[model samples]
Target: MEELWGRRVLLTKQFSAVLDAYQTFPAMIDQGAYMRCTRCNTELLKTAILLPSGFYYCPSCIQMGRIDSSLQLIHQAEPANQTREVFLDWQGTLTPAQEEISIALCHSLAQKKPHLIHAVTGAGKTEILFEAIYRALKKGGRVALASPRVDVCLELYPRLQEVFPKETIALLYGGNEQKYTYTSLVICTTHQLLHFYHAFDFLIVDEVDSFPFQGDKKLAYAVSQATKEDSCLTYLTATPPQALLKEIQASFIISQLPARFHRRPLPEPEFIWWNHWAAHSKKGTHLGKLYQLIDQLSQKNHVLLFCPSIHLMDCLFQHVQKHFPDLQVEKVHADDDQRKEKVTKMRQHHYQLFLCTTILERGVTFENVSVIILGANHPVFTKATLVQISGRVDRKGAYNFGRVCFLYDEQTVAMKLALKEIKLNNQLARKRGLVDEL
Candidate 1:
């Protein structure tokens, strides 16, 4: 029953006997030729998603588990809310601006209102969430901090554990092998929300604008379904997508933080025209500007070189190795089994040049690193993505500002917008006297 608490799960053979003793509801509702998954709100055509046993299943949320016609969902009652002696254990101080936002968040939590924290990169978003989370937990409310990126969940789990040592904090993701237990605090990927039904009383979604989750209806449905009707549902992001921005303007409470916690301006990108860069990299010839930029940046700081496409990253990786035979270099992409290991090594300063695609664009941080984006004009590099990639530089405030170069054959709207947004943040910071004069 502890395992089933706060969760709605399909009645498989393992749960058949246990659930039979309890109560259950249909996992999906039938509507003639179409059946809708109650968990993810995805409608599936019966003919299109027929199981081998002639059962109709939901293909949209199959990643969580098949919610078919034959199965019922069982939900055990959540244990009574339990208070803790100490809900928060942080010793850090927030800037006045951050304190204001944190107070706003706490108000939102108390009111159970939808809210958005529109902060610049490195604006201490996680810390801003701590006080609100503390208020919720102190009152014995169930809370979940979810992110679209698995890396974010992985990074945040340990921090939450450190801050809430007395509370049971569950870390849920696709790759995590830990058994689920009913917990007061849960740090999970957004996709993991599908298993729960009206569980969390305080739901905070970080990186709400990031990939896989962005524009994903199934994942959005997961967030809504996993939350209690009267819960505080807050979104945290450096760059809010347009659709989300509209929603914020229309109804949601908003808090904007324009400066990094370190009181430094975001590093603006330098757009350099490097004609025929990819073709030259593929031919292993005529890479004067590219070689020169790498040599210059790598001398003092680690360089994260971003290629718009994985194939382009591979081609560039080979030439980089040949051109700089003496320097240590590494590359990682979404399919790379060693992605996590490589990123760990990069953070330890093991590589001079780390090449990657958009997978490394956000949710991870490295100190004393500069960023280089190849093909910044490529269709794959959206304005939000470019902003996030540039944000990877100087996150720790090791320097007053970090170098970010976009080596593109042609400048793009995304490039311009990213630069404009960064500049706007810096202006706002300066206007507020949040950053030191250069």
Candidate 2:
């Protein structure tokens, strides 16, 4: 029973039968006059189905394991107190700027205040959270590190496990096989947070500005519900939305890391105009320039070609493969079943180039890689996305510089804004003496 703290399960007939007769209680799960799901707070009455036996069924969150009127949700109460030894085995040290921000973050967490870390890509944001997380765990508080992207969650799991080897750390995602356990720290996707209620004392949301978490209201509600009343919330992102910026200015404590952890400036994107690229692509003509760019990068360093849509990605993939028969090329998107394998292969240097959509724009890093935006003027490419895409280049210390090319028919506001933001961050880094003397 002590191990069931912070665990929830839908009380279906199948689950009811498994419970011991003495442990079964009437008030354990209740169905009120109005049908509503206790887990997701979804009004089941709106999407209810009346059965012949005169009961209602909810289909709203059925995909997450069904919860109907006849079924009740059993949420285990959090433990009152526990004694555990917590230690961090990591030996890496932070930069002076990062150390200052990390100390400030620890102070904010101690005060239980909301804070934001507006850092550039490759700023070692994950390392900055080590001290704060150590403090939280040492105090016997549960910590949750959530990200909007599964790729980010997957990337963070092993790193955190290595750092806190003695503590119980669980990684939760869509297709994970690991069973739910009462762990001191949990790393999960934002969608998985809907299953928890007042569970975490220290909640850190990485990539807070990324998709699904940025615009969706339900995920916002899930974040709010997952944290305790006095829990400290921290948001980590390279590009924060205007609303978050306003909140940072007015209420939240904010810290900024404009330079990469390696003390290198962000790679500024180069805009190259190619007239009638869409028409040429459709007619299968005027691909000489594109080929030349790819050829240049293929000889040295991996390349990531970003397309606006799946259709465009497929078209470009076909074009690139047709033109360069000997080069190793692959295509990946959100629906690709082999996305994980493909990404792993890319990291293993099995593929020379990859044509992909915005799915690869964030949370993945490739060393010695050059980036190319095929249609920089497309409306789908936002300023924040463009910055993230450009950030894919020159992330590792071994290769501290790479080209970021924006191949466009015409420059849009998003392109200019992304470039301007990169330049401004670089300038700030220089002013603070954070950048190398390049």
Candidate 3:
């Protein structure tokens, strides 16, 4: 490996095209790694590169890494006293599995090693992120933890504020209305990442395979565009896509948590198919399951029912209200401004049942909550959604006897895939001794 000006000369890894450097030979290697010849895919021992820019290379299909090889003087932004992080770290206790994952992520960030973390539901993945966030802040490096939902940002804001008492932090998202400064750490949606141009030093994307981020190539592009050169990105997800799964299988680092932070087992979802499910109401059978499930649980506990659409959710709420008038039922959706009120009522125990769409699947956690997914076969229901919905129950042991059941006229391809992924992840974790095999 040789350095010209500030750029690195390598044959294997590819740097981004933004680097002005050019090379005549196929990609060259710094350490004998094969740099594929562009014209003929042949291996070349010597390579010529044009520079002034740090570094550049073709990873067969990608452009990545530093532009110049010269010693770099990194300028880190200092946050205001308000944004400055409090010295207190996560006081909430974590499981050994959680701690192991945290230690690995801290190491990865320090070494600039990229990774894909596939932990189980209720794995306390966010708490594991604390050490890495602290490392970045102490180094005065910019950091970002992005999710696809605003609710997640809202919930994470206070937690971040608690950790970084003196440090300033901003929450960004659609209609967020929060002002971001150069030095502030940020929690935001994938869309908000687009507003940043090479800004963050440490980027962590939660729910990497979740919708909008997973479905939209541009959102992924936005996340890449938001990071500074030489930045380290750690992706967090429960259900990684197929390509990522294969990559993790080959070399990517992974950590697994089969149990919630409370060490309670993740509930196994039973598929419920009623005879008149489709005949009476495409969604009615699902509603019936909810009614029955809630009735069973209401004798002692509260319940949450997930729906794929708002129209049907409203229908279920209206239908159940008459018989269960004694039970408080509420409907909440993305467009509903009364969401705070609805959530508050549920938390206050004013509402016994919540009929919601997929919006509630990921961020929110309720105590003693038993969850049921109505209309698992609904066209909008996807594999990620199903898993997230199932994740809602038994978290942190806020409840005992947690149950997550998927109600469907006929199970969709997505649900089956979800079940398969859940079992596969649990099996892998158990095989590695990360979690016990059921």
Give each model's whole-structure lDDT.
0.87, 0.83, 0.67
TM-score of 3: 0.75
Worst lDDT run of 10 residues, candidate 2, spans 21-30
Model 3 spans with C-alpha error above 4 angstroms: 1-86, 247-252, 276-290, 427-438
Which has the greatest TM-score?
Answer: 1
lDDT of 3: 0.67
Candidate 1 per-residue lDDT, tens place, 179-231, comes to 88878889999999988887888999999999899989989988988888888
Ordered list by lDDT, greatest first: 1, 2, 3
- Each candidate structure's TM-score, on Cα atoms with residue i matched to residue i, is 0.96, 0.91, 0.75
Clashes of 1: 0
Scanning candidate 1 in windows of ten residues, the lowest lDDT window is 78-87
Residues 200-284, candidate 3, lDDT per residue (tens digit)?
7789888877766776655667676667667778888877788767755655566655555664456767888754443344344
Which has the higher TM-score value, candidate number 1 or candidate number 2? 1
In candidate 2 the C-alpha lDDT for residue 284 amounts to 70
What pairs collide in candidate 1?
none
**Per-residue lDDT value at 208 in model 3:** 79
